[model samples]
Target: MLMVALCGAVAGFVLLGHSWLQLLIAGALGIIFTQFAFLAHEAAHRQIFAKGTTNDRYGRILGTAFVGISYSWWMNKHSRHHANPNRVGKDPDIEGEALAFYEEKAVPRTGLRAIIARKQGYLFFPMLILEGLNLHYASVKSLVTRSEKPTKGRFVEIGMLAGRFALYLGAVFWVLPVGMAFAFLGVQLAIFGLYMGASFAPNHKGMPIIPAEVKLDFFSRQVRTSRNIAGRFWPTVLMGGLNYQVEHHLFPSMARPHLARARLLVRQHCQDHDVPYTEVSLASSYGTVVSYLNRVGLAARDPFACPVASQLGRR
Candidate 1:
């Protein structure tokens, strides 16, 4: 079903011939690609295929080759994230080199970067244009230069990705003028970026930021730190069953189809154990994420503004 939709979208983009219709097809392609991304993510966690190796093999194509992302790189980083989400200095998601998501990383900045960092919450959506591109670049780079040891199928990965891009760009540029092609590419990538970010960020963005040294049990850690979005089919499809973020985090190997049922049991278990289970509407979760980012962004300008301290105060 997913593969067919993707092929149709891509085919329409190439065969439509007309520039305006091609642009519409590009939008469909972006949404379809994001769904492919979710499937690839599930594959990385061994949810799609029973065997890790099988999932990895297929995931490489869905992610690195067809989807233009590196599955190996995502797996390595995502494994760490699953093990210790929101942990400062550990979870790769919140790397502080550029914009800080947590109070610990929001020390202070100077110069133009600081000015931009101050408004990162607002800039986050717009910055995703390069983010989609960066995903491809990082994936290839990780495979190409992994501690000089190099990945096993590095050449194959490179060839597949090159072919995918060649076909994609070849179709676009061939079917349309150079300027329209660029515009089409821009819209497609931007939507992909926004779709990707919008899906994942709300899962943990506004939730508690665990300290690097904190050691909690698996169930507690996962449930406490992750937020679930309340919805059924559309949200599940869009989030790739990740609306049950807490459940997904707790059971990394579980299949996406089973996540919804599992969440009910997980929620009951958490209540039995007196653990806080954070769940909210999709809109609510996103609002919290935006509020959290803007709140943390305040710390960039005023050293006294600390979200961590504020959380403690509320507690």
Candidate 2:
């Protein structure tokens, strides 16, 4: 069913050809594809399908088709994120940790590259471009450079990457006229950037950056380490169900369709258990993220300083 929806949407965009209307349609479908990717994420976690090989099979099929990312990569890294949350040096999800905390850092006696790295997260739209590049780079580097032998999962990823390249080439040469192809790619990239930025911005940015040394309890870790955003259906759908990030971090096995219910349950449990639960309207959450980014951008000459090192420097 998900595959059919993605195919129909991609085909619809292809058939429309290169008008402004075609671009609009392609953008809409791109958003739909992003939503499908989220569902694939749920499947990867065995939240959608029965928890077994069936879930793995379905997740790979649906996820790779909608997005170039592999289920293997997501499972390996994303699970680590949930396990460790925001443990500074330990979390794979922490993109250049030091760079993310520029606002609190002291003056740096360092290279010009360091300064740019600190403020890199706030360049906003461009970061999406960097993220796409980072995805490709990381995948390739992992494949070629990993010390361990390639597993079946890695082989599957190789196949998926090849398939993605073929489909992209086919779209360029055979599916549509050159102009229409360019337009399709442009709209798709724009939607991709928007999706990446919006989905991730609220996750951890302004939240207190924990040092590697801090030992936190489970509920305190979750409340302080994660954030939730409030958005209408459009943003939620566009973000592929990630708007309920707090629920996701807690119960990653729940399907996105069930996240709202899960959020209520988690809130109730927190109340009963006396856990410190954090809640913010979606608008305010996103606002907090933006404000943090702006402050980090305007403050330190180098925003990318390692939080631990910077804290020690302050002392």
Alpha-carbon lDDT of model 1: 0.81
Clashing pairs in 1: none
lDDT of 1 by residue, 85-104 (tens): 88887889988465779865
For candidate 2, write residues 1-315 as lDDT tens digits. 655776776677667655557676666655665666677777877787776698888787766645776677677777777777767766776645435543334244246644654455555545564464355556556654666645447777778878886986686557667877777677776676566656776777677766778888766787677876666476567566777777887777777778888888887887898876666776677667666765655454544546667659852
Name the TM-score of candidate 2: 0.80
Q: TM-score for every candidate vs. truth? A: 0.91, 0.80
- Model 2 clash count equals 7
- The lDDT values for all models are 0.81, 0.67
